[model samples]
Target: MARPGRVAVAVPAALLLAACSADPAQPSRQPSDQPAVARSTTPEPSASPSVEPEPQPTPVAPDDLDVSTATGTVRHLAGVVGPREATGPAFARAADWVARAFERQGYDVSRQRVDVPAGESWGVPVSAGRSANVVATPLGFDPTEPHLVVGAHLDTVPQAPGAEDNASGVGVVLAVSAAVSGRRTRLPVVFVAFGAEEPRGPSDDDHHYGSRRYVALLAPAERAAVRGMVSLDRVGVGATVPVGSASDGDPVQRSLLAAARRAGVPAVPDPGQRSSDHWSFVRNGLPGARLGSTPYAGYHSAGDVPAVVERAQLERVGRLLLEWLAPR
Candidate 1:
């Protein structure tokens, strides 16, 4: 994903979907090894030269959502992994927790293990360690269409509870899986809990080891099987939904806009999220986008606890994911 360029003011799709007004007072957070956080948003972008078609109403309505479950999942994920880091006990536990969640959702889960040799972290070299990714593939779906792999990182920064930074995303992935648990779809969708999205230290380049590896192992045919990648990261603090940072012309972005419109969820496509798991898929020529809010005050800090997470925002993101999974 290229750095989000200046957005055009007049696309109806963007304007209609973006419902949140940027609170100047909202704390500003920089991309943390890519937090997948939004840097800007508007209620009405100026205006565009071309018009997009109006989205159709979806049969799926995100009503009576069990946000309590989503909140509970977040609490368990963030709280259980106390001060989690990629190569620690907490992260291992977190990864297992994620695998079980998908298994409970009826998918066959696989834990892909990878070793990182001694390498620089946060600008300093550190000893090598181990980590793994939790992945699950849908059953009984048509094999020809391609797979829609949706993921959220399971690891958090050192010393941070990281409720919004990522547990929020993990929770959404599980909740949405549950929401659509019994349904069938047009294509297979793999839900993943990515390990090592955050660097073992503050090093920017060291992050996203899991996703990059996943992309690498994809046989040319498997890469061809990838429909698109959608990442849910840090979407628990604001009313706005984080649109993925893929090229505006990417099929993933176009479908998401249509999905948001159908769900009637207010959203703003984030431009500054090229640094997360989604970017890994994009580099392979598959359209990818991350959904999240920006400037979480507690981002990469100790204050990012579960108590501050917004349940409604989690529900909104979950609903949107469910909507996207619907058959065209």
Candidate 2:
């Protein structure tokens, strides 16, 4: 989640999907000064990108999402993992834990390595190091087929354990994955636990390294196959979920809002929210949005512990996403 107000970069025309605006004043994530390099994930010879007819399977029951499961994950990340700065060993442990969680649900998990150069984040000097994004896909996932991306950052600022900033987001994604496991859907979905979402420097490029690299490395076909993406960030504190995009009237946002209505969840539209991993996808021409609330009192501070997260909020978000993923 990079902060807004920075000038946008030009991506290759072949990769562009849509254009977005960058406005300032959002207390979002930031990036390091230097460009991060992306590395390949574990090889999967069987699953290759190819255009194919969409699958038309019988609708399966949606998973019964549990709030306690999401809460447990939040506690483990904020309490057990502690402050997981992207360059620290704690981040590595957290990444491993996330990958294992996906594997337990029988998904094909991969760790995409991201190399970040030394830079300053919020005036603090950061050392150059390696981090990885934990990516999970259903078995036999085909890139040519349309799919939805659900992602959350796994790293936290050094000053706090980041229960609300992101542990809450990760917990929701994991809960969704667990509930949907073994269930067939109208569209395939991919889950990513991003690294380095916190700003490493003053520049916008300094943040969202995992998401930026993930989108950058995608083949054109793969990019086109993404129907929409949702970034679940800081969802544990607000009374109502805030579903926002780069600007107003985004189809993805509309779909999410409609889903919320059908699911009987309280949600509101928040336009121009360019402050999370979803912005990475939106700026690159894909339909993307963020599901988060207003900043909490402990934002980027040590006060952002598990106590700030609310169970009801987590349940609301989990139910919203579950309904959104259901076959239309």
Candidate 3:
């Protein structure tokens, strides 16, 4: 782990600040305060008459798996990397750090650079300067098949240090990589650290540069091969999050529900498709799920620090994800 005091320089292109004329009253959204479980349209194996593999005795409880990793990873990401606003060196440094973490765990890593056209905004008029995406792929026993993508954005809005907004998610991905590396699995896993999820310009749709580009570049065959995808956004916020669907009848919803049941984590359903990195995959016809806590009070302000994160909630997310990603 890097020392907390080692402050890195912010990259000039990455430092595109919000316009001074930007609305001061329009703060980022807060975590939702909804119940943890709701009936959602999660995808299930469509009526196949084929006999399914008998569910093996649960090898390990998902909570146990989550508890083993979430606390430390969330603390480190939220605590160490601190705030990672887009276009800054802190964001770049975090990407590098995550890449190294993957390498140390014996995964083959690759980096894809995404240069946001200057002045590009999702729907907002402001323009973002630049960005990058760091990806790590484990040598899968099979390469022709699409890999499981577990990703978290590395950037945050300015003003606050986005510890819970994303540092927590990054930590969970790192911890999961470490935990699953040696254990044999049927599918390949890709851990990606996305840049510029925060609105670079004014609109929300333009914010997910890293993910949008990655999804766009994948071959159609590759895109269709995706078994399941999960985007960990703001997972560090300490709350019992009701899992939501990008769409009401999306297939990913079924996987999450089953995972919650298998992992024994209490989760509810949400129908709203709060824009996040997962939207990229959704556009490409991939089954994707977004996991997050309800709105928090201090989402974009300076108050979103490590202390604000709920360790137990993070564990629930991690454990459920493990169940979802575990061999079916």
Candidate 4:
């Protein structure tokens, strides 16, 4: 991993500061409190079942990816919390960092333990321990209304610096949470950093364990109040936005299209692929959409480090998602 140190983000300092106001309040956390997981609308049939393999995006030069990488967002995050392996100490520490980010945004933060077998990662034998998820909700919202969850997984493969695999996703979620504080939304927004998203067993159930448990544990009332789930996975690289959970012409995809056009983000519709944490929500009848990168060459290797993340791409995806959840 690159030696930990502060680096400059590409945008003008003033612009970055203005986009997310700083908060003086210290973070307040309650780790045991799990946020409500409500039932979402079933994947209602679409007249146009728009599900197809997304075309591969043009390969970006490594130099191009780094030209505008944001230091505070991507670099700082990857450095401070590099390669947080599932259920490992670093993973727990990563959760702390995310909780602090939420508090800095003036939102209350909490943690919920995710069930995983003792001493293992997805059936792969390891000494990794229990994992937990982070949750934060903006204040002064109507509790009666179903809420929208904006989530990203927080775990990485053993000993690997998962910059694009995930740290980028965590940073984008923080950026979005920071940018939209105190704003009203069509549905209340909840920010989560799910643990154990990496495969824990050979079966599909072993993967996306964090979100899967989150949905399974939700009280029926909470489930009933769920409006939707927006999962952000591996979003720090690639220029194109891959919509993983929503099919062509689905309500969630439609909303994303409108938001992307509004935000001027160029995106390619994906086949609502369930390879990421969003699938956890989809199986439980909640509408979901994953915005992520094309593919990273260093995906699960030690080569996946901070320098490879596209700072500008990270900012664009975060901004686009913020627009999608903003009151509309």
Candidate 5:
């Protein structure tokens, strides 16, 4: 999960219902008012306009799933943008880096604003600020069609570089996205790097602000079209991946476990593990699960560096996701 000491706070039924029922605000489109141009008395024959063909998507080969790409991203996020607290300048830089990475992979990228209210991070008072969630989708993704969401938290605790806490998760997500870019799958996928996943205070509402805002902004059709969501978090340290969810018998979690088995990767189930971004979707009446493992020496400390992340572990997670989404 995110941190070691944070506990899961149960969301009130009323709040959950409200969030599920609310509709995203749409922008008003006003018609332009201008004087009409007079038609020519004798219209001349118009020439045929030339049309250029659209560019085709670049196909991703099997060799594109390189371990170095995922390792480099983890090193950069942990060593370069170290201590990326939510809504901070470092976190903003990380978000920008993620957006650029998605653009390089030929995906359409967008940023969703996440407003953080005044709160405390681990008892330290924090001022209200704005953060963002970076979202990436295929060039012509349709919202009304069935789709899947692959997400990972981007922010880290102030005292830790978070190589294992979450830089690893973001790295796996990017690597998986790159490997599946131009491939055909059963459902289209949307990748998101969530901000503000670290606990900002004692309450649960202080965490997962980015993901909660994302789900809240989804239109009814968009929400309904989501088949499932998988949050890759802290998959760098463990030998066996753990697939967890808020409750038992979750179809998404079960599917992930089955996928791992089919891919010949070791994975276990961790029920009632609600300490990541997937909880945001599950609480809002959506199917979601977290794929990660715990029991690391450096949970949220300065010792969580790039050296602690294992490239093999990253590849295992990436391969599992690929098998589940776009199986060869």
Candidate 6:
């Protein structure tokens, strides 16, 4: 997808959904050798944007949330993405876990395997193993109308336990699934655990393999029916820092802020620019936004593990998301 050239790209729907097969995991297609991690002599981005103070929400006492067990579930999910684990198996396990969690909650689930041709940037190939994207949609909903797509990428950068980077995001997705278990909503909700977000070898724009493929594969009607997308990336702990960032002009941004305030989370608008899974949908004219903390010290490092996440933080973020997604 082309970057927003001062304005969003308005490509024809057919052109946007064109088919291509750039599977990176295939050994036959991999360059005879692997390339070193693409280095950028590119200068660090100009002085980071100043963050706006987020609305200070009344702190809900821990007792307010029955989070002991819920937090355990989050930890278990973090363990599933242990550092050093192969990205393929790790993502597959996370996907299966999501499916089983939804099943236990009585929702019918479906899996969509997307095959996207590897583009210019493949960070570092990890066998381009068979990647799969998981989707679970509740039955008994009107299939003709647009649905809310809540998603997260289950994969991580190499060697990072990705506890805060994403396990936090996955944890939130699963937690919401459980929170709404057996409940009814006016709009169908599709929860997805995407794969191949980490850079692959020799492929540019290969960062979002799983999501890119899924979007490309969606039938025109299906793509058009998407109401909006919310991607959760790194919404874990804060450093007791008093800061937030948000773009008040965007409708999706406004909706998220409204949800945070309604749920009483001390969610300050993250003040800096960000790029995550949400970018994929937004580029496709699908309204979407991401939730995460920047300057994550543990990011892309071996030290990032399940222990890095804060349960209280997770619960608060989870509560805010569930409230936004709760049946209206």
Please name the candidate that would achieve the greatest lDDT relative to the true structure. 2
Q: lDDT values of the candidates?
A: 0.76, 0.88, 0.72, 0.73, 0.87, 0.65
In model 3, how large is the Cα lDDT of residue 316? 76
Between the candidate structures 1 and 5, which one is better when assessed by lDDT?
A: 5
TM-score to true structure, per model: 0.76, 0.81, 0.74, 0.74, 0.80, 0.70
Candidate 3 deviant stretches above 4 angstroms: 1-69, 118-127, 140-143, 202-204
Error of 5 at 201 (Å): 1.5
User: What are the runs in model 4 whose C-alpha is more than 4 Å off?
Assistant: 1-73, 118-124, 140-144
Per-residue CA lDDT of candidate 6, range 94-136, in tens?
A: 6787778778867778777755343222234455456677777
Residue pair clashes in candidate 5: none
Residue ranges of candidate 5 with Cα displaced over 4 Å: 1-64
Candidate 3 TM-score versus the reference:
0.74
Clashes of each: 7, 9, 27, 11, 0, 20
Candidate 6 Cα outliers beyond 4 Å, as residue runs: 1-70, 84-87, 116-125, 201-204, 239-248, 271-274
TM-score of 1: 0.76
Number of residue pairs clashing in candidate 6, backbone atoms closer than 3 angstroms, sequence gap of 3 or more or interchain: 20
> What is the Cα-based TM-score of model 6?
0.70
Alpha-carbon lDDT of model 5: 0.87
Q: Positional deviation of 87 in candidate 3, in angstroms?
A: 1.6
Give me the runs in candidate 1 sitting further than 4 Å from their true place.
1-65, 117-126, 140-145, 200-204
The CA lDDT at 172 in model 2 is 95
The stretch of ten residues in a row with the least summed lDDT in candidate 2 is 19-28
Ranking of all predicted structures according to lDDT, beginning with the best and ending with the worst: 2, 5, 1, 4, 3, 6
lDDT of 1: 0.76
Point out the higher-scoring one by TM-score: 4 or 6: 4
